[model samples]
Target: MELKPIKTRKIYEEIVERIREFITSGELQPGDRLPSERDMAERLQVSRASVREAFSALEMLGLLEIRTGEGTYIRQVNIESVMSSLTWVLYMEKDAVLELLEVRKILEVQVAALAAQRANPEDLQNIEEALKQMYQDLQKVRLGEHADERFHFAIAQATHNKILIHLMSALSDTMERTLKVSRSKLYEGKDMPERLYKEHALIYEAIRQQEPSEASERMFAHLAGVEASYLV
Candidate 1:
Protein backbone atom coordinates (compact mmCIF):
# COMPACT_ATOMS: atom_id res chain seq x y z
CA MET A 1 0.00 0.00 0.00
CA GLU A 2 3.03 2.27 0.34
CA LEU A 3 4.11 2.22 -3.29
CA LYS A 4 4.59 5.52 -5.08
CA PRO A 5 5.70 6.66 -8.50
CA ILE A 6 9.44 6.71 -9.19
CA LYS A 7 10.67 10.21 -9.95
CA THR A 8 14.41 9.95 -9.40
CA ARG A 9 17.42 10.05 -11.68
CA LYS A 10 18.68 6.85 -10.11
CA ILE A 11 16.40 4.64 -12.15
CA TYR A 12 17.78 1.27 -11.11
CA GLU A 13 17.68 2.14 -7.44
CA GLU A 14 14.10 3.27 -7.76
CA ILE A 15 13.20 0.04 -9.54
CA VAL A 16 14.82 -1.91 -6.76
CA GLU A 17 12.85 0.00 -4.15
CA ARG A 18 9.58 -0.66 -5.96
CA ILE A 19 10.28 -4.38 -6.34
CA ARG A 20 11.35 -4.63 -2.74
CA GLU A 21 8.04 -3.05 -1.81
CA PHE A 22 6.24 -5.70 -3.82
CA ILE A 23 8.13 -8.50 -2.11
CA THR A 24 7.72 -7.09 1.39
CA SER A 25 4.02 -6.58 0.87
CA GLY A 26 3.68 -10.25 -0.06
CA GLU A 27 2.29 -9.32 -3.43
CA LEU A 28 5.27 -11.12 -4.95
CA GLN A 29 5.48 -14.15 -2.75
CA PRO A 30 8.41 -16.51 -2.31
CA GLY A 31 8.84 -18.90 -5.27
CA ASP A 32 6.97 -16.49 -7.48
CA ARG A 33 8.66 -16.01 -10.78
CA LEU A 34 8.36 -12.31 -11.15
CA PRO A 35 7.30 -10.59 -14.35
CA SER A 36 9.60 -10.68 -17.33
CA GLU A 37 12.11 -7.86 -17.55
CA ARG A 38 10.32 -6.39 -20.56
CA ASP A 39 6.95 -6.50 -18.82
CA MET A 40 8.16 -4.94 -15.58
CA ALA A 41 10.07 -2.26 -17.43
CA GLU A 42 7.04 -1.37 -19.50
CA ARG A 43 4.78 -1.37 -16.44
CA LEU A 44 7.20 0.83 -14.50
CA GLN A 45 8.05 3.08 -17.47
CA VAL A 46 11.76 2.30 -17.19
CA SER A 47 14.24 0.50 -19.42
CA ARG A 48 14.83 -3.24 -19.46
CA ALA A 49 18.48 -2.82 -18.54
CA SER A 50 17.50 -0.73 -15.54
CA VAL A 51 15.19 -3.49 -14.45
CA ARG A 52 17.98 -6.00 -15.13
CA GLU A 53 20.41 -4.01 -13.06
CA ALA A 54 17.97 -3.77 -10.20
CA PHE A 55 17.45 -7.51 -10.23
CA SER A 56 21.19 -8.08 -10.44
CA ALA A 57 21.80 -5.96 -7.36
CA LEU A 58 19.04 -7.72 -5.49
CA GLU A 59 20.58 -11.07 -6.44
CA MET A 60 23.88 -9.88 -5.04
CA LEU A 61 22.17 -8.99 -1.77
CA GLY A 62 20.57 -12.49 -1.64
CA LEU A 63 17.03 -11.14 -1.73
CA LEU A 64 16.27 -12.56 -5.18
CA GLU A 65 17.17 -15.62 -7.15
CA ILE A 66 17.51 -15.21 -10.92
CA ARG A 67 17.37 -18.57 -12.57
CA THR A 68 18.74 -18.30 -16.04
CA GLY A 69 16.08 -18.93 -18.75
CA GLU A 70 13.40 -19.48 -16.11
CA GLY A 71 12.78 -16.15 -14.35
CA THR A 72 13.50 -14.13 -11.20
CA TYR A 73 11.99 -15.28 -7.90
CA ILE A 74 11.77 -13.83 -4.42
CA ARG A 75 14.18 -15.46 -2.04
CA GLN A 76 13.55 -15.99 1.66
CA VAL A 77 14.31 -12.83 3.56
CA ASN A 78 17.53 -12.33 5.46
CA ILE A 79 17.14 -9.01 7.22
CA GLU A 80 20.49 -9.07 8.98
CA SER A 81 22.52 -9.84 5.85
CA VAL A 82 20.77 -7.13 3.89
CA MET A 83 21.27 -4.58 6.66
CA SER A 84 24.98 -5.44 6.97
CA SER A 85 25.59 -4.89 3.27
CA LEU A 86 23.67 -1.60 3.34
CA THR A 87 25.65 -0.47 6.39
CA TRP A 88 28.97 -1.25 4.72
CA VAL A 89 28.08 0.78 1.65
CA LEU A 90 26.80 3.65 3.81
CA TYR A 91 30.09 3.66 5.71
CA MET A 92 32.15 4.50 2.62
CA GLU A 93 33.61 8.00 2.70
CA LYS A 94 33.99 10.52 -0.10
CA ASP A 95 37.75 10.27 -0.01
CA ALA A 96 37.59 6.52 -0.22
CA VAL A 97 35.26 6.83 -3.18
CA LEU A 98 37.68 9.04 -5.09
CA GLU A 99 40.50 6.69 -4.27
CA LEU A 100 38.56 3.88 -5.90
CA LEU A 101 38.30 5.89 -9.12
CA GLU A 102 41.97 6.74 -8.93
CA VAL A 103 42.85 3.09 -8.69
CA ARG A 104 40.55 2.30 -11.60
CA LYS A 105 42.24 4.87 -13.78
CA ILE A 106 45.64 3.52 -12.90
CA LEU A 107 44.67 0.04 -13.94
CA GLU A 108 42.13 0.52 -16.72
CA VAL A 109 44.14 2.94 -18.81
CA GLN A 110 46.89 0.37 -19.10
CA VAL A 111 44.30 -2.33 -19.57
CA ALA A 112 42.78 -0.57 -22.56
CA ALA A 113 46.15 -0.17 -24.24
CA LEU A 114 47.03 -3.78 -23.58
CA ALA A 115 43.69 -4.95 -24.84
CA ALA A 116 44.18 -3.05 -28.05
CA GLN A 117 47.52 -4.70 -28.54
CA ARG A 118 46.76 -8.20 -27.37
CA ALA A 119 43.08 -8.96 -27.60
CA ASN A 120 42.14 -12.05 -29.59
CA PRO A 121 39.05 -12.30 -31.74
CA GLU A 122 36.98 -13.68 -28.86
CA ASP A 123 38.00 -10.83 -26.62
CA LEU A 124 37.08 -8.32 -29.26
CA GLN A 125 33.70 -9.97 -29.63
CA ASN A 126 33.02 -9.68 -25.93
CA ILE A 127 33.95 -6.03 -25.86
CA GLU A 128 31.75 -5.40 -28.88
CA GLU A 129 28.90 -7.26 -27.22
CA ALA A 130 29.08 -4.92 -24.26
CA LEU A 131 29.24 -1.94 -26.57
CA LYS A 132 26.21 -3.20 -28.45
CA GLN A 133 24.27 -3.52 -25.22
CA MET A 134 25.26 0.00 -24.22
CA TYR A 135 24.08 1.36 -27.54
CA GLN A 136 20.77 -0.46 -27.28
CA ASP A 137 20.18 0.81 -23.77
CA LEU A 138 21.10 4.36 -24.69
CA GLN A 139 18.68 4.35 -27.62
CA LYS A 140 15.97 3.74 -25.03
CA VAL A 141 17.29 6.55 -22.79
CA ARG A 142 18.60 4.12 -20.16
CA LEU A 143 21.82 4.90 -18.31
CA GLY A 144 23.41 1.55 -19.28
CA GLU A 145 25.61 1.43 -16.18
CA HIS A 146 25.75 -2.36 -16.19
CA ALA A 147 26.76 -2.39 -19.83
CA ASP A 148 29.40 0.20 -19.06
CA GLU A 149 30.82 -2.09 -16.41
CA ARG A 150 30.75 -4.95 -18.87
CA PHE A 151 32.68 -2.90 -21.42
CA HIS A 152 35.37 -2.08 -18.88
CA PHE A 153 35.48 -5.63 -17.61
CA ALA A 154 35.97 -6.83 -21.17
CA ILE A 155 39.01 -4.61 -21.48
CA ALA A 156 40.37 -5.96 -18.22
CA GLN A 157 39.83 -9.53 -19.33
CA ALA A 158 41.63 -8.83 -22.58
CA THR A 159 44.74 -8.04 -20.56
CA HIS A 160 44.97 -11.79 -19.91
CA ASN A 161 46.61 -10.98 -16.62
CA LYS A 162 45.05 -12.96 -13.83
CA ILE A 163 46.05 -10.44 -11.20
CA LEU A 164 44.46 -7.56 -13.08
CA ILE A 165 41.34 -9.60 -13.74
CA HIS A 166 41.04 -10.47 -10.06
CA LEU A 167 41.58 -6.86 -9.08
CA MET A 168 38.86 -5.64 -11.41
CA SER A 169 36.44 -8.29 -10.20
CA ALA A 170 37.08 -7.25 -6.61
CA LEU A 171 36.51 -3.59 -7.40
CA SER A 172 33.40 -4.16 -9.52
CA ASP A 173 30.89 -3.31 -6.80
CA THR A 174 32.61 -0.08 -5.83
CA MET A 175 32.95 0.92 -9.45
CA GLU A 176 29.25 0.23 -10.01
CA ARG A 177 28.32 2.31 -6.97
CA THR A 178 30.41 5.23 -8.16
CA LEU A 179 28.92 5.03 -11.65
CA LYS A 180 25.37 5.16 -10.26
CA VAL A 181 26.26 8.23 -8.23
CA SER A 182 27.76 10.06 -11.18
CA ARG A 183 25.41 9.05 -14.00
CA SER A 184 22.77 11.66 -13.21
CA LYS A 185 25.31 14.45 -13.15
CA LEU A 186 26.98 13.24 -16.31
CA TYR A 187 23.72 12.98 -18.21
CA GLU A 188 22.16 16.22 -16.97
CA GLY A 189 22.55 17.73 -20.40
CA LYS A 190 20.14 16.45 -23.04
CA ASP A 191 22.86 15.49 -25.49
CA MET A 192 25.30 13.96 -23.00
CA PRO A 193 24.37 10.33 -23.58
CA GLU A 194 24.85 10.64 -27.32
CA ARG A 195 28.23 12.22 -26.74
CA LEU A 196 29.13 9.47 -24.30
CA TYR A 197 28.17 6.82 -26.83
CA LYS A 198 30.36 8.45 -29.44
CA GLU A 199 33.27 8.56 -27.03
CA HIS A 200 32.88 4.86 -26.35
CA ALA A 201 32.70 4.17 -30.06
CA LEU A 202 35.94 6.00 -30.61
CA ILE A 203 37.63 3.92 -27.96
CA TYR A 204 36.22 0.73 -29.44
CA GLU A 205 37.36 1.69 -32.92
CA ALA A 206 40.85 2.41 -31.66
CA ILE A 207 41.00 -0.99 -30.05
CA ARG A 208 39.61 -2.65 -33.16
CA GLN A 209 42.28 -1.05 -35.24
CA GLN A 210 44.98 -2.23 -32.86
CA GLU A 211 46.05 1.30 -32.12
CA PRO A 212 47.28 1.06 -28.57
CA SER A 213 48.09 4.72 -28.10
CA GLU A 214 44.73 5.83 -29.45
CA ALA A 215 42.97 3.35 -27.22
CA SER A 216 44.78 4.62 -24.15
CA GLU A 217 44.15 8.23 -25.06
CA ARG A 218 40.46 7.63 -25.70
CA MET A 219 40.14 5.69 -22.47
CA PHE A 220 41.82 8.48 -20.54
CA ALA A 221 39.54 11.07 -22.10
CA HIS A 222 36.46 9.06 -21.23
CA LEU A 223 37.54 8.61 -17.63
CA ALA A 224 38.48 12.27 -17.42
CA GLY A 225 34.94 13.18 -18.38
CA VAL A 226 33.67 10.86 -15.68
CA GLU A 227 35.96 12.50 -13.13
CA ALA A 228 34.93 16.00 -14.09
CA SER A 229 31.25 15.16 -13.93
CA TYR A 230 31.63 13.27 -10.66
CA LEU A 231 34.14 15.37 -8.76
CA VAL A 232 33.77 18.88 -10.10
Candidate 2:
Protein backbone atom coordinates (compact mmCIF):
# COMPACT_ATOMS: atom_id res chain seq x y z
CA MET A 1 0.00 0.00 0.00
CA GLU A 2 1.33 3.36 -1.04
CA LEU A 3 0.66 6.43 1.08
CA LYS A 4 0.57 10.00 -0.24
CA PRO A 5 2.87 12.62 1.25
CA ILE A 6 1.43 14.45 4.21
CA LYS A 7 0.38 18.03 3.52
CA THR A 8 2.72 20.58 5.00
CA ARG A 9 1.34 23.26 7.33
CA LYS A 10 2.96 26.33 8.80
CA ILE A 11 4.64 25.60 12.14
CA TYR A 12 3.07 28.56 13.87
CA GLU A 13 -0.37 27.55 12.61
CA GLU A 14 0.15 24.02 13.91
CA ILE A 15 1.17 25.44 17.26
CA VAL A 16 -1.97 27.54 17.30
CA GLU A 17 -4.09 24.45 16.56
CA ARG A 18 -2.43 22.47 19.35
CA ILE A 19 -3.14 25.16 21.91
CA ARG A 20 -6.72 25.53 20.65
CA GLU A 21 -7.16 21.77 21.09
CA PHE A 22 -5.89 22.05 24.64
CA ILE A 23 -8.43 24.77 25.30
CA THR A 24 -11.21 22.72 23.69
CA SER A 25 -10.32 19.63 25.75
CA GLY A 26 -10.50 21.67 28.97
CA GLU A 27 -6.77 21.31 29.57
CA LEU A 28 -6.59 25.09 29.35
CA GLN A 29 -8.93 27.45 31.10
CA PRO A 30 -9.37 31.16 31.48
CA GLY A 31 -6.64 32.77 33.59
CA ASP A 32 -4.52 29.61 33.36
CA ARG A 33 -0.86 30.33 32.74
CA LEU A 34 0.78 28.88 29.64
CA PRO A 35 4.21 27.27 29.58
CA SER A 36 7.16 29.56 28.85
CA GLU A 37 8.04 29.95 25.17
CA ARG A 38 11.33 28.09 25.64
CA ASP A 39 9.58 25.17 27.30
CA MET A 40 6.83 25.01 24.75
CA ALA A 41 9.30 25.22 21.87
CA GLU A 42 11.36 22.39 23.33
CA ARG A 43 8.28 20.30 24.02
CA LEU A 44 6.95 20.78 20.50
CA GLN A 45 10.37 20.45 18.83
CA VAL A 46 9.87 23.84 17.10
CA SER A 47 11.75 27.15 17.24
CA ARG A 48 10.93 29.56 20.03
CA ALA A 49 10.10 32.13 17.36
CA SER A 50 7.36 29.88 15.99
CA VAL A 51 5.90 29.50 19.45
CA ARG A 52 6.09 33.24 19.99
CA GLU A 53 4.30 33.88 16.72
CA ALA A 54 1.57 31.43 17.68
CA PHE A 55 1.19 33.11 21.05
CA SER A 56 0.86 36.51 19.40
CA ALA A 57 -1.84 35.21 17.06
CA LEU A 58 -3.71 33.62 19.93
CA GLU A 59 -3.50 36.87 21.90
CA MET A 60 -5.00 38.68 18.93
CA LEU A 61 -7.89 36.21 18.76
CA GLY A 62 -8.63 36.74 22.46
CA LEU A 63 -7.78 33.14 23.25
CA LEU A 64 -4.65 34.16 25.14
CA GLU A 65 -3.59 37.31 26.92
CA ILE A 66 0.07 38.29 27.10
CA ARG A 67 1.05 40.54 29.97
CA THR A 68 4.36 42.38 29.74
CA GLY A 69 7.13 40.57 31.66
CA GLU A 70 4.60 37.95 32.78
CA GLY A 71 3.56 34.56 31.50
CA THR A 72 0.77 34.32 28.93
CA TYR A 73 -2.68 33.30 30.20
CA ILE A 74 -5.91 32.23 28.62
CA ARG A 75 -8.64 34.86 28.51
CA GLN A 76 -12.41 34.48 28.79
CA VAL A 77 -13.64 33.58 25.33
CA ASN A 78 -16.41 35.44 23.57
CA ILE A 79 -17.06 33.39 20.43
CA GLU A 80 -18.72 36.19 18.50
CA SER A 81 -15.89 38.60 19.19
CA VAL A 82 -13.34 35.97 18.23
CA MET A 83 -15.21 35.24 15.01
CA SER A 84 -15.37 38.93 14.15
CA SER A 85 -11.64 39.27 14.69
CA LEU A 86 -11.01 36.26 12.49
CA THR A 87 -13.28 37.63 9.79
CA TRP A 88 -11.39 40.91 9.82
CA VAL A 89 -8.11 39.05 9.24
CA LEU A 90 -9.52 36.81 6.55
CA TYR A 91 -11.03 39.61 4.47
CA MET A 92 -7.99 41.85 4.27
CA GLU A 93 -7.23 40.78 0.70
CA LYS A 94 -8.41 42.85 -2.26
CA ASP A 95 -10.28 39.89 -3.75
CA ALA A 96 -11.99 39.25 -0.42
CA VAL A 97 -13.04 42.89 -0.22
CA LEU A 98 -14.58 42.74 -3.71
CA GLU A 99 -16.38 39.53 -2.84
CA LEU A 100 -17.70 41.18 0.32
CA LEU A 101 -19.05 44.05 -1.78
CA GLU A 102 -20.89 41.49 -3.89
CA VAL A 103 -22.28 40.02 -0.69
CA ARG A 104 -23.32 43.48 0.45
CA LYS A 105 -25.32 43.92 -2.71
CA ILE A 106 -27.13 40.65 -2.06
CA LEU A 107 -27.67 41.11 1.69
CA GLU A 108 -28.36 44.84 1.90
CA VAL A 109 -30.85 44.85 -0.91
CA GLN A 110 -32.95 42.38 1.05
CA VAL A 111 -32.22 44.30 4.23
CA ALA A 112 -33.60 47.48 2.72
CA ALA A 113 -36.76 45.69 1.71
CA LEU A 114 -37.17 44.35 5.23
CA ALA A 115 -36.60 47.77 6.72
CA ALA A 116 -39.29 49.20 4.51
CA GLN A 117 -41.77 46.67 5.81
CA ARG A 118 -40.84 46.74 9.50
CA ALA A 119 -39.29 50.09 10.35
CA ASN A 120 -40.81 52.07 13.22
CA PRO A 121 -40.69 55.83 13.71
CA GLU A 122 -37.46 55.58 15.72
CA ASP A 123 -35.82 53.51 13.01
CA LEU A 124 -36.80 56.07 10.40
CA GLN A 125 -35.39 58.82 12.60
CA ASN A 126 -32.10 56.96 12.92
CA ILE A 127 -31.79 56.54 9.16
CA GLU A 128 -32.68 60.18 8.61
CA GLU A 129 -30.06 61.23 11.13
CA ALA A 130 -27.44 59.20 9.33
CA LEU A 131 -28.42 60.87 6.06
CA LYS A 132 -28.13 64.28 7.69
CA GLN A 133 -24.65 63.34 8.88
CA MET A 134 -23.72 62.25 5.38
CA TYR A 135 -24.90 65.54 3.93
CA GLN A 136 -23.02 67.48 6.59
CA ASP A 137 -19.86 65.54 5.81
CA LEU A 138 -20.30 66.27 2.12
CA GLN A 139 -20.60 70.00 2.86
CA LYS A 140 -17.37 69.79 4.86
CA VAL A 141 -15.62 67.97 1.91
CA ARG A 142 -15.18 64.77 3.93
CA LEU A 143 -15.51 61.20 2.69
CA GLY A 144 -18.43 60.57 5.05
CA GLU A 145 -17.70 56.86 5.14
CA HIS A 146 -18.70 56.53 8.79
CA ALA A 147 -22.02 58.20 8.13
CA ASP A 148 -22.49 55.88 5.19
CA GLU A 149 -21.82 52.90 7.48
CA ARG A 150 -24.27 54.24 10.02
CA PHE A 151 -26.87 54.57 7.28
CA HIS A 152 -26.53 50.93 6.29
CA PHE A 153 -26.40 49.82 9.96
CA ALA A 154 -29.56 51.74 10.75
CA ILE A 155 -31.32 49.94 7.93
CA ALA A 156 -30.08 46.60 9.28
CA GLN A 157 -31.31 47.52 12.75
CA ALA A 158 -34.71 48.29 11.33
CA THR A 159 -34.95 44.67 10.19
CA HIS A 160 -35.04 43.57 13.85
CA ASN A 161 -33.33 40.30 12.90
CA LYS A 162 -30.84 39.40 15.60
CA ILE A 163 -28.82 37.10 13.37
CA LEU A 164 -28.63 39.71 10.59
CA ILE A 165 -27.46 42.33 13.09
CA HIS A 166 -24.79 39.95 14.37
CA LEU A 167 -23.65 39.15 10.85
CA MET A 168 -23.41 42.85 10.07
CA SER A 169 -21.41 43.40 13.25
CA ALA A 170 -18.98 40.69 12.24
CA LEU A 171 -18.49 42.21 8.79
CA SER A 172 -18.37 45.80 10.01
CA ASP A 173 -14.62 46.35 10.02
CA THR A 174 -14.02 44.88 6.60
CA MET A 175 -17.02 46.72 5.27
CA GLU A 176 -15.74 50.03 6.60
CA ARG A 177 -12.35 49.53 4.99
CA THR A 178 -13.96 48.56 1.72
CA LEU A 179 -16.11 51.70 1.74
CA LYS A 180 -13.20 53.97 2.58
CA VAL A 181 -11.25 52.77 -0.42
CA SER A 182 -14.22 52.91 -2.78
CA ARG A 183 -15.37 56.33 -1.61
CA SER A 184 -11.88 57.76 -1.96
CA LYS A 185 -11.69 56.63 -5.55
CA LEU A 186 -15.26 57.66 -6.35
CA TYR A 187 -14.84 61.12 -4.82
CA GLU A 188 -12.15 61.93 -7.39
CA GLY A 189 -15.01 62.79 -9.73
CA LYS A 190 -16.77 66.10 -9.15
CA ASP A 191 -20.42 65.84 -7.90
CA MET A 192 -19.90 62.15 -6.90
CA PRO A 193 -20.70 62.78 -3.24
CA GLU A 194 -23.88 64.61 -4.08
CA ARG A 195 -24.88 61.78 -6.41
CA LEU A 196 -24.30 59.31 -3.57
CA TYR A 197 -26.37 61.41 -1.21
CA LYS A 198 -29.20 61.51 -3.71
CA GLU A 199 -29.12 57.73 -4.06
CA HIS A 200 -29.35 57.32 -0.29
CA ALA A 201 -32.15 59.86 -0.10
CA LEU A 202 -34.14 57.92 -2.66
CA ILE A 203 -33.64 54.70 -0.72
CA TYR A 204 -34.67 56.36 2.56
CA GLU A 205 -37.77 57.82 0.96
CA ALA A 206 -38.82 54.43 -0.42
CA ILE A 207 -38.41 52.88 3.02
CA ARG A 208 -40.25 55.74 4.72
CA GLN A 209 -43.16 55.28 2.33
CA GLN A 210 -43.24 51.56 3.21
CA GLU A 211 -42.56 50.49 -0.37
CA PRO A 212 -40.51 47.31 -0.06
CA SER A 213 -39.97 46.71 -3.77
CA GLU A 214 -38.97 50.28 -4.44
CA ALA A 215 -36.65 50.21 -1.45
CA SER A 216 -34.99 47.04 -2.67
CA GLU A 217 -34.60 48.42 -6.18
CA ARG A 218 -33.09 51.65 -4.96
CA MET A 219 -30.69 49.75 -2.71
CA PHE A 220 -29.55 47.54 -5.57
CA ALA A 221 -29.04 50.56 -7.80
CA HIS A 222 -27.04 52.34 -5.14
CA LEU A 223 -24.81 49.34 -4.48
CA ALA A 224 -24.32 48.81 -8.18
CA GLY A 225 -23.33 52.42 -8.56
CA VAL A 226 -20.77 52.08 -5.81
CA GLU A 227 -19.38 48.91 -7.33
CA ALA A 228 -19.13 50.57 -10.73
CA SER A 229 -17.31 53.52 -9.24
CA TYR A 230 -14.97 51.22 -7.36
CA LEU A 231 -14.13 49.23 -10.45
CA VAL A 232 -13.44 52.43 -12.39
- Cα displacement (Å) at residue 163, model 1: 0.8
Tell me which residue pairs clash in candidate 2. none
Candidate 1 yields a Cα-based lDDT of 0.79
Residue 167 in candidate 1, Cα distance off native in Å: 1.2
| Local accuracy of candidate 2 as per-residue lDDT tens digits, 1-232 | 1112222357887777678878877888889999899988777778889889989988877788999899999988886646655564555455676788888799899999999999999999999999999999999998877788899999999999976776776667676665665667676578988998999999999999999999999999999988887777
Per-candidate alpha-carbon RMSD to the true structure: 13.1, 4.9
Clash counts for all predictions: 0, 0
TM-score of each: 0.58, 0.75
- Alpha-carbon deviation at 78 in model 1, angstroms: 29
> Candidate 2: deviation at residue 119, Å?
2.0
178-216 per-residue lDDT for model 1 (tens digits): 556566667665787788878888988999999999999
- The deviation in Å at residue 136 for candidate 1 is 0.9
Q: Which stretch of 10 consecutive residues in model 2 shows the poorest summed lDDT?
A: 1-10
Leading candidate by TM-score: 2
Candidate 2 positional error at 222, Å: 0.9
